[model samples]
Target: MQKEIKAIIDGWRNYFQGSSSVGLTLAQERAVICSTCEYAKYGKHAAILPDAQIGNIQGYYCGVCKCPLSTAVRSSGYECPKNKW
Candidate 1:
């Protein structure tokens, strides 16, 4: 019985993963970085990622903006970063 239930759960998880939207656009990704930028606390709203320069954002920033960023991503038709499993 436990194995059967686990199989059903695994199937649903896989289905959702395949059907979900992911990733980000250049502009939106920048906005994401800005909102969480470390400099944001000191009044900076610009995204200055030196590595990728201009692409999908994936790095450290203010934890304060995590919730809002997650919401924005969801509203923009993408899955939350924490839900990518």
Candidate 2:
């Protein structure tokens, strides 16, 4: 739980500090992987990952971690629950 908060902090800090929230490369890479992931659920799961955007896709929540990918991908604190990233 605490780790999630730290990841959010790091992600936002990276965003405000630069043009990209997930940094330049790694974050984008993570997003790319997540874009095709079946676990990146949305629609009815909107509340958990609201206002989300990843690469070209809309919003989504990681079915494994159950967190917003937009924010989670940006952070170094949060790792892919499935270790894909």
Candidate 3:
């Protein structure tokens, strides 16, 4: 049990050390609109609604509301202009 715990700790330390690369979820990378739900207000769905990919946008869904959210709205950083379509 001690060895297992030590191994886990070492793995975490390595991850943080930047010796290896770590992937980020849409929520963590700021690539997706919604990190909790699936409701995309501007489009049929926010980019990367299901799976989060590096170099690609991610979508978040609201577990409570079951709706997709825009990162801009969630973060309150910036509001992208609505698409004409």
Candidate 4:
């Protein structure tokens, strides 16, 4: 829980600092890790909105912490909860 909060805060801080995201290669690497993670859930059904079809539903997310994997992976300072990245 604390980690999630810290990640969010850091994300916001980075955003305001004008350098929030990582390079494409690093982000892609993180994506690959998140995609294969057991705790990473794909699709909207995993988020409990079975009827909705959000664009990011196709992206992966951490099932345990409920953080959006796409956004999380793009943030260089963010770390995986399970250390998969």
Candidate 5:
């Protein structure tokens, strides 16, 4: 719970500071890790409903920490609860 709050705060800080949270290469690397993780869920199982207006991005979600993979990977300060990334 504390970690989640910290991650959210850091994300907001990065946004307000106009800072790049994570590089594309690093984010991709993290994505790879997430793809093979047992705790990862995709499509509807990820609990991310499609938003037709936004092109219906099917994002991944973590079963453990319950954070969206897209947001988690992009947050430089975010550490995987299981220390996978």
Candidate 6:
């Protein structure tokens, strides 16, 4: 819960600073970790939207934290609920 708050704050800060994306390398590394995690879930329902997409893959969200990886990875203040990040 606390981590989510920090990420939200940091996201807004970055948005206003004209920096919406993180370093590509870091993002890729995080994505790779998420991709192979057991908690990674493909979002197929309207209520559960994907947080990121790779190629034609729809996207995935963390089953534990219920966060969209696409958005969470981009936040500098984000910490994985499972401490994977």
Candidate 3, residue 35: Cα displacement in angstroms equals 23
Ranking by TM-score: 2, 6, 5, 4, 3, 1
Candidate 5: pairs in clash: none
How would you encode candidate 5's per-residue C-alpha lDDT over 1-85 as one tens digit per residue? 7866877676445434545367656766877888789988765533443322112123667788777666666577789889987
Per-residue lDDT of 5-58 in model 4, one digit per residue for the tens? 777666545434544467656666666677667887775544442212223333
Error of 5 at 63 (Å): 0.5
What ranking emerges by lDDT with the best candidate at the front?
Answer: 2, 6, 5, 4, 1, 3
- What CA RMSD would candidate 6 show? 4.4
Give candidates' CA RMSD values in order: 11.5, 3.7, 14.9, 6.0, 5.2, 4.4
How displaced is residue 39 in candidate 6, in Å? 0.4
Evaluated against the true structure, the overall lDDT of model 1 is 0.35
True-structure lDDT of candidate 5: 0.63
**Residue-wise lDDT of candidate 1 within 1-85, one digit each (tens)?**
6654443344334323432123334335544655455533322212332223222232333344332232233232323344422
For candidate 6, list the clashing residue pairs, or say none. Answer: none
Off by over 4 Å in 3: 20-85
Question: lDDT for every model?
Answer: 0.35, 0.68, 0.33, 0.59, 0.63, 0.63
- TM-score of model 4 relative to the true fold? 0.60
Give the Å shift of residue 33 in candidate 4.
1.0
TM-score, predicted candidate 3 vs. hidden true structure = 0.24
Q: Which stretches in model 6 have alpha-carbon errors above 4 Å?
A: 1-3, 9-21, 45-58
